[model samples]
Target: MSESLATDTAKPLNGRLAPPRTARVVGLGHRLPDRVVPNGPIAERIGVDADWIVRRTGIRERRYAAPDERTSELATAAARRALQDARLKPADIDLVLVATMTPDELTPNTAPLVAEALGIGAGAYDVGSACTGWLAALSIGASQIETGRADAVLVIGAEILSRVIDPGDKRTAMIFGDGAGAVVLSADGEGSIGPIVLASDGGMGDAIIASHEDRIIHMDGHTTFNKAVKVLVESTQQACERAGVTLDDIDLFVYHQANGRILRSVGEKLELGDERVADYVAETGNTSAASLPLTLSLLREDGRLRPGQRLVLAAVGAGFTWGAGVVEWGLK
Candidate 1:
């Protein structure tokens, strides 16, 4: 159950601190509760329709947490899978980072529980940056490795929005789901962690927050969307520059899965086109922090992502948080 695993991708790259020849993405995994909430059923239950939900948010279906499933448990499940995929034991992990606003207890920290379950005895903590949680974790994890404080880190985005999603609120119930996705990041002892950019606009936090109603989700979609587009474009540009790459030179884009409209808006502003941005809201709904990393893993499995492609990983979510990262696929 060690944390560091035998990876098919980890290999000796270029200079240690300089431009890394590569940073292999060792493992990837995800977990979703057993309950399936089809669009029609959800719509019927909410007095809405399939077309109605799709037209508004592009969410066709989503998964809900089992009544007994805790947020930490779901995260642990995903971490175990990722460890297995990387052929790593829990003890091998040097750090553990959990991204969630729907934490199990909000104390003792979800990261420690996940590490305890995985057998990793490294620094552990939870990040509560709303939808931007996972992407922020990626940046933080990369930094730890880049600085040598930790060579390997487990970054997970897990959510059980049902804990806060008002089932009666047709606007949100149709758009949120429960799921978790995790990845293993290591330093460039063999590769490098490049230009990563993260930004925040606390002013917009009120646009899509779940506070007043005991922290239940309450969002202003139009306002949130407008800000998302602008932040996404700016983040992408800044990260690309830091990575020493041009915007036009980038290949694929993995963005937070909130809405198809949001994705289209970013692409239009940046001229990235349909091939550039990967949006999964149509299939998975808005999984909050888990959306971007989940899609990245899927792309890897489907062979839709080729090695050496410059990837822009970005997110804009609650707290009005946003960030962009430039990653050249770490491959053999």
Candidate 2:
């Protein structure tokens, strides 16, 4: 996380510098389960009315994975779509990175399963940064490409938060959903992805946690809301500065879809109009790590994303982890 406007570079052991390389996003894909869970049922279970849920979180409905579906399945589906969008085959990928907090099992990791399902023999791993997992994984994948370690990498953010949220807990129950999203990064295009700024504060880890005893998510809403806004704003600014651009130069601001009120507060603080800030939380709820990429896919479907547009991405998650990055849209 250098505070400089330069592509990440690496040096060889012979005391020579490798030519600077850049990773560009060549494809995007996302998947949402068929079952739509509206706020009405969730509100009833939490002793609140549907309108109260809407006013508090601005989430009208959310998708839930079926009992037979697992995180790996969702990830594999999204990865296939991304591969198709990139016009790439399984063998084209050199590495696979899945950002997930809710994995299928406690032993075997999710990425390897996804790779096997996709018929890709590429090296695979998982990044577990909760909601900020996608941006963290994106930074890692881009670094691999920039350092000449891989030509193409598939980065995914998937979560089945419904499995972790306690149905009786209003704080966590009303705020989570299930889905997966993915992107293909390759060294084939111009340097479309810019510098990423990542940081964390472990002391605040208690703000959002799922204890092993109960295996249910619990959150201190007030603490998370205040800290999330502060960190998101700061990180976004830092990412822009490192990219040698200002907020005005960014075509869109895609913060983590944690809550609608938090998004609005961030926008008001940044003096950005509604047109500039994205608000997909109303429909997606909080998809945790899947929020960023899923929102990007939706934006593309709605024709809001353009090839030359510049966008800023930011997120703050459970570990009190946070990251932000700039992207010069290059997808065709």
Candidate 3:
């Protein structure tokens, strides 16, 4: 972990007292599996045309992990790239937080395996907020830095949804993919990551679930879609307000890559133009927890993300969990 003083409070934003210390995203990386599963085959399995899949979910194809691939392997790969991008070694990380609902196993959790693979001795754990997991983990990592609990943290979001989706079930089969993404955060002299607003509605937990009987994901598409759009919009608004910025001030809007329709609807409600909102669901499908970070990596690779840009990140997931946050891009 990097050393830094924490006694001084950051300047207030719109009368909101910022944290005394802030965490800045210094590096980012993502990994997608080699296998590309197009909607043509999936559509045949579900008795729908390829065009129907695209129309409904805006997903033309998605990556699927090999049968031998483990979730931790993807996470470790992404984390290594993030370390390299940050110009830091594994030893510099004080904590490793992996957010994933699909762990390599239930007993040991995924973070430790990822840390071990990276040869980092940092304390590690998992966060299971489903699709909202990455933003939730980011909040946790940033909070640790803000309180001086740790100086450098490695936050990762990884998912192997292909293993859990029933190929015949159109609800999930057409929407899920496999991938991992990671970011390295370090304490900064001024806060770059802003307030994160998190909330949930467990009463709607059944809207998306994976029962023990089948260990396969089931979702009420209509219910999840309606609730997702509403929460995503509301959370983004709340995050902007907390950050002392208006919607117009955001340079980019990155929401969970759940569905193209959902993203478009959220943009319509927010009155944001297409260029301002990210729509990567078409390429990566819904990676659950990996969605947000994966999209972030894509943006960076395409040169859409730059230092000092303001961004709003948001997501809604099962457990009815949802979150949004503001970040000022810090990587050069």
Candidate 4:
């Protein structure tokens, strides 16, 4: 009946079901290529004004690819930064998980190629779940550490959507960007890791999806906006409940940076204050699975998140998929 009990009600659901384990984050980093495409230039291409875009989506600028950059380049840069933060060499990694909708090469999978580039050997592969890709990767890494299958896992969210965007259509050209973010997941025995909840409804798969069939971002903006807000709120509540923390108890909350309006809707649902959530949609635009981690990198740079802080990672996109997880930050 009380708010505190209601706040963490979902955590016990996962706790009574799964055995205890230990997990923690050791490092974090991100990278974006050196191209800034502002709304005014995009408006000229799409026959819309900067004012119209701002009024509708609240995006000012987004990064794009250089003539030479690709998805692999972005991911590798972010991964290197993450490894540097951890103060370890590439060979120290036991596993690498790349969360991406756009793979550099369709055959061997992007992970192995990334491993080869970063010199991590054959202990790498790829995971695809559209915008929810990173959260899915985080969940998989958590399980590996909890079960002792891996001592350290490199989780990355990277995208080079500009290459796939239809330059002729301003609708998408204005909405997408290119970037990557990485984090090292491991165990600390202090219960730094907690419950995670993931959900899906394939029927809305078209709402915000890009197909490799034609390799284009096809989105029903209104539908995607509505669904993202609803699902993220549900998962956020579920994650908080499972983590034994109330929304108010969380030090910071991070969500997929699709749009400023969408972020506001989710914030309203959880009664979260502006200080609790960070917004980068204005700068990075929507980098698919890369959005949240990139936002985390920016926040951490300014010294926002710290030990003993509860973090909520939430996202909804493509495959009509959605997920939320609560990670307790306290790594030495």
Two-way lDDT contest, 2 vs 3, winner: 3
> After TM-score superposition, what is the CA distance of residue 112 in candidate 4 from its true location, in Å?
0.7
lDDT of 1 by residue, 38-101 (tens): 7897788899779988888877888888888988898999888887877777877898999998
lDDT of 3: 0.90
lDDT values for all models: 0.78, 0.89, 0.90, 0.81
Which consecutive 10 residues in model 1 have the weakest lDDT in total? 1-10
**Per-residue C-alpha lDDT of model 2 across residues 1-332, encoded as one tens digit per residue:** 22223244653412334337778998899999989999988889989999998888889999999999999999999999999999999999999999999999985989999999999998999999999999999999998988789999999999999999888888878899999999999988543687789999999999999987988999999999999999998998888877778888888899999999899999999899999899999888999999999999999998998877889999999989999999888786
Per-candidate TM-scores read: 0.89, 0.94, 0.96, 0.92
Q: What is the lDDT of residue 225 in candidate 1?
A: 81
Q: Which candidate has the highest TM-score of all?
A: 3
Order of candidate numbers by TM-score, starting with the best: 3, 2, 4, 1
Flag regions of model 4 displaced more than 4 Å. Answer: 1-20, 189-191
Question: Which 10-residue span in candidate 3 carries the lowest summed lDDT?
Answer: 1-10
**Regions of candidate 2 where Cα sits further than 4 Å from its true position:** 1-19
**Tens digits of lDDT, candidate 4, 1-332:** 11222111223443464434565778889999898999988888888889887777778999998977778778888988888887778877899999998787777777777788899984787888888999998998888877778888899999988888887775677888999999887664232566678888987776766666987887888788888899999999988877666777777889999888889888988788988987888988999889878988988877887766678889987889989988777643
Better of 3 and 4 by TM-score: 3
